[model samples]
Every structure is written in structure tokens, then in C-alpha cells.
Target: MAGVAAIGAADLVAGFGLAGALVLPAEDPESVLAAWRSLPPDTAVIVLSDAAAEVLRAEPAVRAPDAPLTVVLP
Candidate 1:
């Protein structure tokens, strides 16, 4: 798991030219929340699953009290 996380972090830096963090998790809400929290303000989030988007949409903190969360679903 540690090795996988290292590789994923490396891949993100290599591909995105970002020293940004990447969180790959063992399960659902935790992974989703981690991804959400790790991203900076105004950054775009692209979700591969509609179901996951739905879950994300339901989180008030994810959307915020005033600002809408930007998510692209494929």
C-alpha cells in the first residue's frame, strides 16, 4: 500500500507537473473526502463515476454553504 501510494504520488507529479498531494484509499467516503480536502480552492475535480459524483454532491462541506463544487462526470 505504501509502495502504491508512492507510485501514485510520483505519477501525479510526473503527469500534472504538480507537487500536489494524491490520496488513494482503501474505501469510499474516506477516499472521496480525502480527495476533496486535498485539492486547493477553485481547482477542478473530474470524477469518473456518476455514483461517486452523487455521493460527493451530497456532502455539504464538499459543495460549501455559498460556493458550488465544480465536478466533471464521465
Candidate 2:
């Protein structure tokens, strides 16, 4: 997990093919959104936060059919 966060580090192993960034206090939706936008066009945005997923669902960024958005609800 090179760029993975520390909190939810173990949750994304299967999705990322390795450990993923852990969700920390400093890494809120805004920060995660920025990172999501920075990813390549083909990159996927997998949301592990149920609340965050609901919020993102209302955003235009997540409306497209193939917008590379995934919501993993708890």
C-alpha cells in the first residue's frame, strides 16, 4: 500500500489489487475528491464511505454511466 491511507488500509486490497489508502481525519471528502479528480481518465473512484457515497451520488461528477464511480456501502 504505497499511497494507501492507514485507517481503512485493509479494506481496499481486493479493489486496488493491493492495500489502499486509509481514511483518516485529515482525508475528508474534499481531499478524496481532489485525488479522485487527479486520477487518469480511466481510473476508478471507489467510495467506501456510505455517507460519502450518498453525497457523491448527488454530485454531477458521479452521474455519468461510465464516470468511474463506485459506492461501497457499509
Candidate 3:
């Protein structure tokens, strides 16, 4: 449990970089999942844009009980 990471469209997630979060800009559902799969070891929080959240809404891995806290922005 440590820093924050964000994955989503460039415009939506760009601000996260200002806070020193690991920003991974993804274009599609697959890319979002790929980013999720490769999170840094120190990431304790993951922030996803609404579009990304919708893409992963049915993904079991994203909703895994043991995964880090995930926040989806509107």
C-alpha cells in the first residue's frame, strides 16, 4: 500500500501526473487491461476514468477481492 496510479484516456488522466502518480494512458479496453496487469509494485491505489471503468466493469481480475483500491472518476 503506497502511491497512486491512473489508467485511462490521455486528457482524463493527465492531471494525475501532477500528483506524481504513475500515469498509464490507455486507448481501449484491452489497453486498459494491459495497464492494469502491469501496475508498479508500490501502487496502493488505482484511479480509472469512467470510460476505463466501464471497459473493466465485467472483468473479474479488476474486481478481484485482493487487489488494490480502485477509484473511478466521473
Candidate 4:
């Protein structure tokens, strides 16, 4: 888990060059969905957990083709 956290942090830093804001969603699915839906179209959502990522991927509200969503699982 520590290694995953370290990689996630590094990825966050590397993603800074992108054109949108970086979002780290909560562990819960509902919270993740809420945060994802609230972000702008260009925003980058970094989902760390497999569970949350699965939920977000299944959620239609956050599945816009134009939305920049990234799911990182470990």
C-alpha cells in the first residue's frame, strides 16, 4: 500500500502539466461520484482504489466522453 501511495503521489506531480485541475476522490463510491460530477469537463480525476474506480466507471453521471478521468488501481 505504501508503494501504491508513493506511485500515486508521483503520478499526481507528473500530471501537473495537464490542462485541468487534479482531483483525488474519496474512498467511497458516492463521494467519488459526487466529486467527479462536480468537476469541469477538462478536470482530471485520479481514483486510487479499485472499488471507487469501479463505481466511477459504472456511473453514468461521470462518464462523459469529454471528461478527463483517470483511474489508477493498485
Candidate 5:
């Protein structure tokens, strides 16, 4: 379970049969967007707070048909 923050890191795991999970911070929408863009198709992105989820949903790029984005509220 590696924390990937860039496209290069995501590329490293390509074809390794590894599942990628991105845990995003609530306060940093830009970071979330960056991470979302960096991940490969089918990556599971978990947004930790509603604030972050809102931010993610607002970003048009985050709504990829092939990727799964989940919002986990506490």
C-alpha cells in the first residue's frame, strides 16, 4: 500500500496487478485534483471529509467514467 502523489508513481504500479487507493485531505482541493489526475484508470479514491468530497465533485476531471471515487464521511 504505497501513497502515490504523482503520475510517475502511478506509472510504476502499472501492470503489477496492484490495487491503488488514494486517501485525500479535506482542506487541500488542489492536492486532491492533482492526485486524481495522477492516478490511473480504476483507482479507488477515498475522500475523507465532506468538504473534500464537495471539492472533488466540483472538479470536472474527477468524474471519470472508469475510475471510482468514494466519499467517506466521519
Candidate 6:
């Protein structure tokens, strides 16, 4: 399985998939959650765009104590 995943703006993450990162160019919370839920279980890192990070502010799944490392882009 892949080691990294990304979810956020299309323009920012659209090309990340080329590098083998699981990229989901999503903007809404629903899409964001869907992206997260669909990631390969072995994914280790997750990068979120500013907007996508905000959408997940109150979300526990992605913020779980044992969840993958998450980085929020500025």
C-alpha cells in the first residue's frame, strides 16, 4: 500500500497523485470525509489544504489519536 495521501484543493493536490500519493482534490466536508475513508489502510501521512482542514476541524475520524500524521497547508 501507498505511504502517503492528500486531500484538498484541486489545483494544489491534483498533481500529487503522479508522485504516488493518494490524492483527492476535494473541497467539501463530504468529499473530504469520503476521501479519507477511501484511503488505503497503510497510508501514513495526510496533507490537507487550508479549506479542507477547516472542514475537518470537528471531525474525529481524521483527528483520532491513532490516525495518520496530518499536515495542513497554509
Positional deviation of residue 17's Cα in model 5 after best superposition, in angstroms: 18
Runs in model 6 lying further than 4 Å from the true structure: none
Candidate 5 local lDDT, residue 58: 76
List TM-score per model, in order: 0.43, 0.49, 0.89, 0.49, 0.47, 0.86
Each model's C-alpha lDDT? 0.41, 0.47, 0.90, 0.48, 0.47, 0.86
Candidate 5 regions with alpha-carbon error over 4 angstroms: 1-26, 45-47
**Candidate 1 ranges with C-alpha deviation above 4 Å:** 1-27, 42-48, 65-69
Q: List candidate 2 segments past 4 Å from native.
A: 1-26, 44-47
- The residue pairs that clash in candidate 5, if any, are none
Tell me how many clashing residue pairs each candidate has. Answer: 0, 4, 0, 0, 0, 0
Off by over 4 Å in 3: none
- Candidate 3 per-residue lDDT over residues 23-60, each given as its tens digit: 99999989998998899777789999998889888889
Quick one: best TM-score, which candidate? 3
lDDT of 4 by residue, 1-74 (tens): 11111012334433533533353435456666665555544444444456656766676655567545465655
- Model 2: per-residue Cα lDDT over 1-74, one tens digit each: 12332212234323443445334321356754554455555455554455445445567876777776465645
Pick the winner on lDDT between candidates 1 and 6.
6
Q: Order of all candidates by TM-score, from best down to worst?
A: 3, 6, 2, 4, 5, 1
Best by lDDT: 3
CA error at residue 63 for candidate 1, angstroms:
2.7
Error of 2 at 66 (Å): 2.7
How much RMSD separates candidate 5 from the native structure? Answer: 8.5
**What are the root-mean-square deviations of the candidates from the true structure over C-alphas?**
8.4, 6.1, 1.3, 8.4, 8.5, 1.4
